[model samples]
Target: MAAKLEGGAYLSSFVDAVLEKLSPILEDDDFVLEENDSALELLGRLERSLYDVGSVLDDAELKQFSDKKVKKWLVDLQDALYKADDLLDELSTKAATATQRDPDQLQHKSLRELYVEACDSLKLLPLGDFPNLKKLMISKCQSMECVVVPQALPSLQYLSISECPSLVSLPALTLTVPQLEELHICDCPEINCFAEEFLPPSLKTLEVTKCQKLASWITSKGLQSEGLTHLWLGPCFDVKSFPREGCLPASLQALKLSNFPNLETLDCKGLHHLTSLKSLAITDCEKLENITEEHLLPSIEHIYIGEDCPLRWKLARRDGRPMV
Candidate 1:
């Protein structure tokens, strides 16, 4: 008899709590039910039913001690209330989901610059057409593997991607972003090569660092961009030699190679055609010992060689060479 009274009291409190939760939900003006009129009607009916049951709760609790059938009825009413609450929760969740998936809620069309960082579960970005987007930067996204670029980004100028270890390759960007001027990629180890045959012709600056597989591919296939002027490749331990023959374009004016621990040779044949090349920097190359020919640097007006390199001592001994 004591246990029955305790259960009755718990049910009375539970009914009050459910009614309290339902009241605000039914009265909330901002709670949208746009296409779910039936769900709205159902919620209204459920709210009324809760109110009716709440009025009888106190009477039912008192009578439950005397009548076993009244106790069973209260227990059955509690079970029905549980089902109603679950339905209300499901309806609210669906409404919230619908609001979130609405495109007008995000307003992505007018967005100019987008930066995504540290999203551990993000696997792919299916980028849509953003006509006015100028710069895109992505970093530290551990699970991000691909970015789907379906169409052209006519006004895009700069793009940078870094620290995404799972990324395998870039989308075909050669013809997609015609006005792109600068691209910087760093610390992404899984990317072996560009997805396209060549980078955009309008690209003027390109920087790649710490990506060994990509560095190896660049060394073998050569960096092939006609208008590229400033280039930096470095700290890529796997690269043993600078530009293979015809690897660099004649339009290149400034180049920097640093921290290549395995770099041993500089092929003069690769440097001979770089008539526009003016500034050169080589630093922290511990194993670099050979420069195939010294005269090939005729156009170079400034040179920076790090102290740790044996090439620094060699360049220091050479006479009539431009060194800075």
Candidate 2:
């Protein structure tokens, strides 16, 4: 007997239902359990964690809209759970087919089959099927080049892509995702440009790392959002300076820049326009010798610069000096 609660269905019970349906098949003599012991152990751990997660989801559902942070946390949690479920399904299918056979022949067959399956899974990402998708993350897909967004995604709030070295660009993906709120791109070196209109007005946070050729955000009328609250750019060596034209978002509240060896200076005029900025961090820019704060706003409260930075004295505010 199951309790009839008046809210979202519990995920733990869903997993239990799956296990109940699959129990008889797993007990069959054709399904050798010993051959799939490792996968089953992992599946057990995932199931237990998901059971704990269901409580968190239930709690969040009751108070999500009242708190912005809670809503964001729920989105992230749901995205992670969705990915875990996909991987669990794949592992379950693999386990169901595991069987004992001659040692030498079984070893060779398993290796070839696993390699083919891994390759196929890495190349296919069917995001277009979800009409109300929010928060998508595609990681470790080495052979992926293009991610196609076929339809409008008004509900999408976050997107993250990482470790896809062969990916050249996001083609026609951002056009349909106008409501995206956060984006993170990491370890994708071959990417060159984030074209105009790539970032929408609804975006609040953007983080990029180790993208070698991505010179600057304002290169060609791109990344000119006024609603951005946080921006992080790191390990992008080719970008020698912040855009000289003062194109950064005026509504930005936090900014972080790191590991740009070629970066020489940041245009003070642009930095001055960030009236809402509360935190600014710059690190590991070896060649950054000339930084000006002539027009910097007084709203900035926290400032962090590397030891090599020449503008450290300008950031200090303990001696009754104004942060002008």
TM-score of candidate 2 to 2 decimals: 0.59
Candidate 2 local lDDT, 74-132, one digit each (tens): 66655655566555445444442233344343232323112112222344343333435
Q: In model 2, which range of ten residues has the least summed lDDT?
A: 111-120
- Please give, for residues 1-324, the per-residue lDDT of candidate 1 as tens digits: 236445556766776777776776677654646446786688778778777887887888888779989888877787776776555554443333232334454344555887766656667755665767889998987888987777888888999999999989788888678899999999999999998777899999999988888877887788789999999987777777787779988899999987888999977888888989999899889898788886556788888888788887787787546456
Which pairs clash in the backbone of model 1?
A: none
lDDT for each candidate structure = 0.78, 0.62
Candidate 2: which pairs clash?
none
CA deviation > 4 Å runs, candidate 2:
1-121, 215-222, 293-295, 313-324
Name the candidate that leads on lDDT: 1
> Model 1 — which ten-residue stretch has the worst lDDT?
93-102
